[model samples]
Target chain A: MKVTGAVKTGQRPRGIETSKDGKFVYVAVGDDDTIEIIDAATLQVAGKLPSGEDPEQFAIDSGDKYLYVANENSALLTIIDLATRQKVGQVAVGIEPEGVAISPDARIVVCTSETTSMAHFIDVEGRKVVGNLLLGARPRSAAFKADGSELWVTSEVGGGLSIVDPAARKTKQVVKFAIPGLRGEEIQPVGINLTHDGKLGFVHLGPANRVAVVDGISHEVLKYLLVGQRVWHGAFTPDEKYLLVANGASNDISVIDVAAQKVIKSIQVGEMPWGIAIAPTRDR
Target chain B: MRLGIVVLCVAVGWCGVSFGEPSQQLKIGYMWMKPSKIRVSLLDVPADNDGLAGAQLAIDDNATTGQFLNLGFDLVDREVSKGEDPTEAVKELADEGVGMIVTSLDAERLLAVASAAMAHGQLILNAVAIDERLRAEDCRGNVIHVAPSRTMLSDGLTQYLTWKNWKRWLLVVGSHDNDKLFADALRRSAAKFGAKIVDEREFKDTGGARRTDSGIVEVQRQMPLLTQGAPEHDVVVAADESEVFAGYLPFRTFVPRPVVGSAGLVPGTWNAAFDQWGAVQLQNRFVIKFHRPMSTLDMQVWTAVRMVGEASVRTGSADVAKLVDYIKSPEFSVAAFKGQKLTLRDWDMQLRQPILLFDGRNTVSVSPQHGYLHQYSSLDTLGTDRPSSKCKLN
Candidate 1:
């Protein structure tokens, strides 16, 4: 409540990632080649790390040791040592990368580029490009199960999803469909959410303005749930019982019952609050 | 039949023709839906917060603008779900022979609305959805996007961050897995403009256990340490979509730096508090219509409606296709909050406009302020330009 400034950055920020110990908060300052860190208490800046150009997408290792940033313009993954907060290495891949996910073991990182039609994986320990798996056209964001066994990537242009196997370094499944009352092309699939158990995954379809529930194991789209105008991403509650979709154009968050797969409420945030994440309430 | 054929061709590509001469009822159809039940708490939103506020704004705006042209416009709001069959909803509107429709649904729904409208040879004026895919792979000739794409919004924010010289940042996210996705956008922006992120952290959504008083003190103590050792940072950026505690960042932070991104300076389509350049006047009018503050959804819908009014005043009829073409033309302009004017890109049908960078409380600056120039138009600096766009108009 003390620090007052402008939120004159990013478009619909989705995530609010804090340190493992809940010390610092890292925000993806969309469209800028930088991230903002604030002291959790005073909410002040303690430092800055170097990311690639146009870095909107990012991933952190298991121990929170390494931070991987996907620079959209340079099309490379810039790696920084969390301990030093300095750029240590880089991995070049794809065009206009937007989404980033790290393996459960923190051994690998996956990034999805907007137009590249692929999600590239990097070996976190070696800091090198290790995998490039084919996906639906215009993949924007991806989701990795809590255990890191499987991954789901959404294709905004192709209106589908690509499932990958981190252990096998291959795309295990591809799911596509045409829902009524939507345009085929605009039926772009984006934003994926997986349960902790990795049994159910929710995807926000770009043009469809809805989220599709998929069986994570078989990569089958089980059902569709209405979200909002251009629903882009989903933010899950700590209990995983609720899921909120950031509807880019609707300029609000559509709250859904994950168990029911239906929107129960809609809350107004700032305009296009695309990047969203829910943190466990402090034990206050 | 021959004469009818010629008339149809002329209608398909009508341009610069006087339409106001004829007092016609402007026909329009819209498509929308209710989201699933689960998304409520996740977004920290309420159910009644649907974007209908935008639809109301358009109707009010037209009420003011309609006096000059005598163009009577009426909108029939049709709500549909995933399996509800938009074909019928769209047909009901098209059956009325409404050519142009302003919509605030997802990309697929818009496409369905567009196709259904087009099947009846109608045009769709999309008022919402910012996903780049709508402008890229899913783009259509019959659809004109009236909303600013995410690229535009992000780029607008990025330019200001670079201008502010607060190049270094420390980012914080919430526990939702999607926090990384937003962090991705911030990362991209940082990379493009030669900025840097000191470090990143995740705040777990460990359920609402705030009845006691242990979490805040611990988080307060822990945050400063995590950000330690980063040479220097200019700002603290927090992406708390869940609004867990990042809203409490800034000032409490260990170091003194300007915080931007989500909490500090925020970029959006429209803000209820935005009044600079008399933006409050528009806001007031919108509040009168919906009895609540207007959001980005209302703004986008207001823009689409205002576009119709602008083109109708200039071209004259509800001849939907003709009006659509007028909007798509580079010459078209709309008066939004930004001081100057806004247009549309020919290649991808993206809106060309300036962005208002607000420091949470007030407006700090606007992007593309003469210094930021592009080869095509200054608006090119707002988002992906012709050279960078892969959208091919078929």
Candidate 2:
């Protein structure tokens, strides 16, 4: 629990993800419209990859062969071949695309557009959109079930979560949250995370300053853990013992005990913290 | 309604199919009359498609969201000439199956259109008329206001000034009828917000071209001289809705003071320089598409059209009555890149939104300034509250 040396990347950095081997980290530089690669070992700038306009969120395949980026301004998903470091194809999507999630098998990718409120499914093999599933308003994040049977998308403005039947390309169910003493419009659902076993789910309620714990199997709300202001994005540690959430407005991170379903600690972070990335524990 | 069927068919045909389901077309009508006004600055001139552009952009945005829901949106724009009866225009759009119309018209024309639309069982969203009567004594159940009433704008500006401790004000009002009405709103705001108007002066409109080579010297000399010897005040509030002398009051005031209201630091629902609360994405998209900055009128029309889209999406249908009821319901709220969700006032069907204080180049601040709280929503602090509102819609 200490501070690491910071590496300046680019302006308005949004989504971040580590490579499968945890060797490199990719950051979507939104304002710069390029994905910057950071060498995890050296904690230094590695290289840059060309992306579409206003790239916010992206997904890397399990094989780490390609990168799929959601370009908010361009309304296109730019596919980059990791090894070649070149954009291979572009698939037109709905407006203001923000979230990207690839299935466990890496055969399918789901891109969620904020304004369009659609979860577009793309075929990795064909490098094209296969189908689209409509959800609530302003869908910001997406996560697939461990078995790839269901895709869960969070609608920030719609204040609900839509669980889609991935194979059939239809919404299986929608889970809405109603907190006591809070208005319905305040219950905005943003980032979502599911346990490795897929038995539990954690949803960061943006501006609501709370995390909803859901029974993964039942897709029902189990409990709510109050967090910081504007709880934007979250990530689980490699061991999956604790969950860390970035509070964009509060400029801090709330650490939750996965087993206890409670907030254990608050860690101060950079101003307006957004996405979070955790690397594998290494021998000191 | 043969025209309505033809337009509806074209809209549905262009949208094609969404995931094998034929798209359900939803058309919103845009009816407006261009305001012919000359301003001191070329930048202040209104674009030919000021409000229409906003509706067009909203249609594009709605269509994007509609794609996933098997819903499609289209805009049918109808422009009326001066002294033209807008009833025919309203009927034409209604005949085309357009159940919702967004208008940027004067009070008279807007009222006429509303009456005509009500006959056809269509709803109207007023995007431009700021006359208080439209939201008060003349309030129509069928006409929902997207534009902030004059009192709302005045209150937004007054709150910011009051928060800044600039409580004393020198009011300069134009003689024109609209300007006088705006002046009344400012007077009401100053009284309600605990600011005292130290003194007031009237600026008569001497008929002449707004722009001329010798005009600047004359205005420069006339403004300060007219403003001279006025009671001491912290700010000079101008009410020149006719685009007469407000812009010239900023730096040309006799006493060194900040100018506000119709010029200088102004209050509006949207501005070209607003980039907060994820508004930059919208501004960027608009600039890329329209090749110009988005104006307050544009944003108003955009909000009006999006309101229709939101209702259609929530109710999952294009039925006019259902959508109207849903919009007027407490359940309906819309996100317009504002920090919080905007809801319509159930009392008068006026959209409640945060007003931006623009200083021409950048957003100076937003109204409902911190600490000005209301029991329900802080936004209600800027406009006609339910208790004070004269609107009686059943």
Candidate 3:
């Protein structure tokens, strides 16, 4: 319901993720090309780890042993060894890699390139690309279902969400967004997240200023929740009771109550707040 | 690491299976006139690849989307020297099956190429020429103008000035033909927007070098004399598109009035400092790719090529007629980081976009200024409307 605290990081901070144990939060500082480590308990930046050039988005593996970062300018995935806080290796993907995601089982990593329009599949252990699935233009972010059966990637310019079958390594369905009065170009899908039960999905329509709620099974858009301007990314709280979306233009985060499916509060953040990551409460 | 190796092996095994044949190729042509002896300001010189660089970036962007739809896009760039005919280049590109050509030529040269390629049914996107006649009496059926016309620029400036309550203007125009044309547009815009041009003057070219070691001292002395004795006006409107003396009027004006037009707060397609409506991402990408800030000329060409790519993807075909039809349809719109979709006017084929009022450093405002509304789109207020269009596209 409120912004408990805020921590200053390097310029253009984008992707954020909490460690598996929920003790630390990793934020990708894009312009600085480093991931700032925050002590979740204190909400203070405690350390920094080297990432690839212009790291925009990143994902932590299931075991939290490694972090995969999508470097927008470098076109490579920088794999960081979390324990040692060092980059172990890098895998060449596509041009302007902006979105990175890991499977629920932590076996595969998906990196979506904005300029190349390709979703490259990387083997976690081999640290090399296994295969690639061509996606829509300007793909921004990706999320895996809780069960790991499907992967959803949001394409900003293409204005559609591509649902891929992880096993088949191919796109199965593309759910395009079109509002009654809004043009197709305005409905840019950027960040996507699915509920832990895989029953509900939320897609941040960049510039459209709305988050689309879709039924995970039928892929039907159930509702369009209006939010602040230029909404870029979203995250579910540890309790899964609310969704917090970062609006770049509005410089605030819209908190959506899960049960009521409406915006409950607008939490003011730093200038151009892009990505969001939620940490579990201390008791959890 | 062991699981990664096993998965990689299996993926390599699956990669051997082939898919369907590659998509059809969509070839586009970029035709432009080589840099000519145009008046250049010592302080603000033009980039050599101003229009071409933008076209190339858009081609790269289009190819990214094309790759996913089983469509391939190729750009054939042709730059002809001064006094060289561009018709040959257009014919050659048409012969090579290029259905769309983005051009950065003057009004006459563009007309020549358009006429030459008309038989081939090629669609020509005008990216540079801002001559109002091109969108008026000289409009062609196959020519879709991506650059804003002189009228549009003037209208944009007038709207902002009117909104600011600066209702009176001192209009100064250069002797060049393009300058006169722009001045005419300003006059029309003033009449339509309820502003009065208190005084109008023409500054003849008088034939002299623009940039010299000692030109600034002379300019500082002469600018005030040239602007002196004008009636009471809120702003000085300069129509010096030729870059002759307008840049000198900013700080050297007699009455300390703000200048607007080709200098001061100018209306343009894009500005490097513009970061609104998610334009920072685009500006960053352009800077990364070109290692330079994008100019207005580059943005015009980029929009043209992207329109072609959008049409190709939407129609699901590379056929020339189909692409042209789609672009002319109301459903066709291209997002050029302008916070809205830009579409072509059905009557004149001129692109409808909000003009950014930019000073050298930052965006002052975007015009169609807040209250001006049209029945169709607010953008229509910036240029010729359908009822008043002189274009008779056949």
In model 1, which regions exceed 4 Å deviation?
A1-284, B1-22, B34-50, B81-88, B111-117, B173-181, B203-231, B239-248, B251-256
Candidate 2 chain A has its poorest 10 consecutive residues by lDDT at A275-284
Docking level of model 3: incorrect
- Model 2 residue runs over 4 Å out of place are A177-187, A215-226, A281-284, B1-23
Where in model 3 is the C-alpha error above 4 Å?
A116-137, A162-187, A281-284, B1-26, B37-40, B57-74, B162-167, B191-196, B212-214, B272-293, B306-335, B339-342, B366-381, B386-388
Distance from true position, residue B79, model 2, in Å?
Answer: 1.3
TM per candidate: 0.50, 0.91, 0.86
Candidates sorted by DockQ, best first: 2, 3, 1
Best by DockQ: 2
True contacts kept of 1: 0.00
Which candidate comes out best when scored by lDDT?
A: 2
User: Taking the candidates one at a time, how many backbone clashes does each contain?
Assistant: 124, 1, 0
Return the number of clashes found in candidate 3. Answer: 0
Per-residue accuracy of model 1 over B1-394 as CA lDDT, tens digit each? 5466445534542211212333666755666676444321233242454566676656645543343345667776777767776768778877777667777677767777766776777667777676677788888887778877766766777788788787887887777744554566667767876788878766676775443478567666765764556567888776654455565565667776666655667666776678743365567556665677676666777777667766765566667767877877755666565533466788988777777777656677777543675545566777667877878876
Task: State the C-alpha lDDT per candidate.
Answer: 0.67, 0.86, 0.83
RMSD of 1: 26.3
